[model samples]
Target: MGQGRLPARLGLACCLLLLLLGGSGGLGSRGMPRGPWEEEQGPVAEGGPWGRARYEAVKKHLRAVGALSKQYWQYLACKVWQEGCEEEEEEEEEKESSPSPGLEADLNEQLHGQHLAKEVVVRAVQGFLQSPQPQKALVLSFHGWSGTGKNFVARMLASHLYRHGLKSKCVRVFISLFHFPYHKYVDSYKAQLKKQISETVQLCKQSLFIFDEAEKLHFSLLDAIKPFMGRYDNKGQVDYRRSIFLFLSNLGGNTINEVALDFWRAGRAREEISMEFLEQRLRLELLEPAENSYAHSHLLEENLIDFFVPFLPLEYHHVKLCARDAFLARGLPYTEAALDEVARMMVFVPKEEKLFSAQGCKSVSQRINYFLP
Candidate 1:
């Protein structure tokens, strides 16, 4: 070896021997390497060894990793190691974000009457979600009277689509009067609404936004939503194609009720009141309204709304069914006679046929207080 290199190599070897000798050697009581707990509990040897295990232990204690759920801990581990985390995360998101396969069954069981709503909502949602790359977000405008299952069906959709239902961060419900009461704050509401939509879509790819009393929403607020609902998917921008926006309104209740009454008067089944019969009329009714209304908004003018789902007014039989459900839900025992009493207590319309319930089972549950002893 060269004289200069020989001395440098010898110096490194000597340093290694010195550290081994000065620190822990092969296993003796004092020379043995310390464990995680011992390092924390025992007196500090400032320049001592701190291995991966000790750091991991410190992380566990400091982060309260033990208190986390198994799924969360698995996620944390997967996040750090990145072994199959993408697949697991995607799978979990799909389960949480996608509409429930049981939605049809839920509609059948929970929702009474309104065959049009049941069929349209289920078919439209399923078809929209199945599309690989949808052109625009699924826009469903539900038109009907109060207690006609608009809000109920909205809740059902949210519950089925997300793990946390209406409470999900990915889901938002804006009641026009509650969220934005004053017409004076329209400008501020528009900005806030747009920001909320952008942030929500960024956080969750498949989000659900339900606008209750949608008919009362200011024209500016609806215009604010135009950009998000329009077919505009940039390369690295917020893609709203996978999202769903639902508008619940009682704007066309009269037209829908008239048709239902006409069908009843002609001895036709409510089921036979076809979508063709009501959809055209409902669309016209909503479109031919006053200026600055839902019809005048960009959403309708551009025809961005995919489907106009109409909820038919509930019948006395339907109201009775609702009472039955309420009774069952409350675990209260009731007879068919009791159900009829509750149904009859609700006000019916047309004054002569008294065919449909005016309130449409709106207060059927609270009305149960009548029979309580």
Candidate 2:
């Protein structure tokens, strides 16, 4: 369907170029030929000084126009047809091995209100990739509330590391409530989970396996992945040390919020809330045997999960910033009042004070349609 547009675009470009060259009282067909007066003045010796100068001048203008036409054609072709644009693809392929800088920059620019995530995730992945002989796969457990940018950060990691990002064959995402809801099929779930992981690691030298709503994952199913993340690779087996595993969940979201609230109440800077403060609290919650699946997980027991990255709750200004970004992304004209309106639409928690966004920036993008023209 789009093929027809290419020739049309080139034809339009030609017409525009002709019009540009042929302006008011300007040269037309046969008026100023491509080269010097060929038939009218057969040779340079037959032409006068004025004719010679005109020939040289025309030659100079033609040379300049030729260079410009070549450049314009290249630009037009790349824009309309998207041909010869492999530089971006090549750069993406190159960043596969060294992606910390890009990931860090993306986290800083795109993801807001998560200091620890921006700091730690890039560092951990960079270190793991640089390690010549890693003992096990790099595992990052992302804990936060919905819309706190856990999935966003995961995507940033994937985009920087893989050319196709999450869509890459090497990257796999498993959601809890959707993928494995029935406890009756836990046995089969374990088998399928192992098979998928094995196949992915075997197919790609490096792989990314993401388990969303990880806290709700069946303990048995979670245990099924233990072999792949073992400290030592089994002899003559698919090696997984080069892979990365991400566990995204809301398991410790409340704990993280409580800690943030405590810092606020204490009049301490939010930046002062360190990783140690929340890691211990999150670990305690995960270890409890009564509530969820983290308790019986082998990943925790063996201390195989390398990092427990926390996604802090978002604030009012952070939501505004997110809304501003949304407006820019959607190419909609906005004002401070529009941004305020979008942020006000969100339900905030601690009802009396309305300190934090209850849903973070989850639906902010969809809400922008209300203000669309």
lDDT of 1 by residue, 210-312 (tens): 9999988998889888877888658647788888999999999999999988888898888998898799998888888675368768787798889999999
The total number of steric clashes, by the backbone 3 Å criterion, in model 1 comes to: 0
Worst lDDT run of 10 residues, candidate 2, spans 33-42
Best by TM-score: 1
Alpha-carbon runs more than 4 Å astray in model 1: 1-95, 233-236
Q: What lDDT does the true structure give each of the candidates? A: 0.84, 0.83
Question: 20, model 2: CA deviation in Å?
Answer: 41
Error of model 2, residue 194, in angstroms: 0.9
Q: List the residue pairs that clash in candidate 1.
A: none
Clashing pairs in 2: none
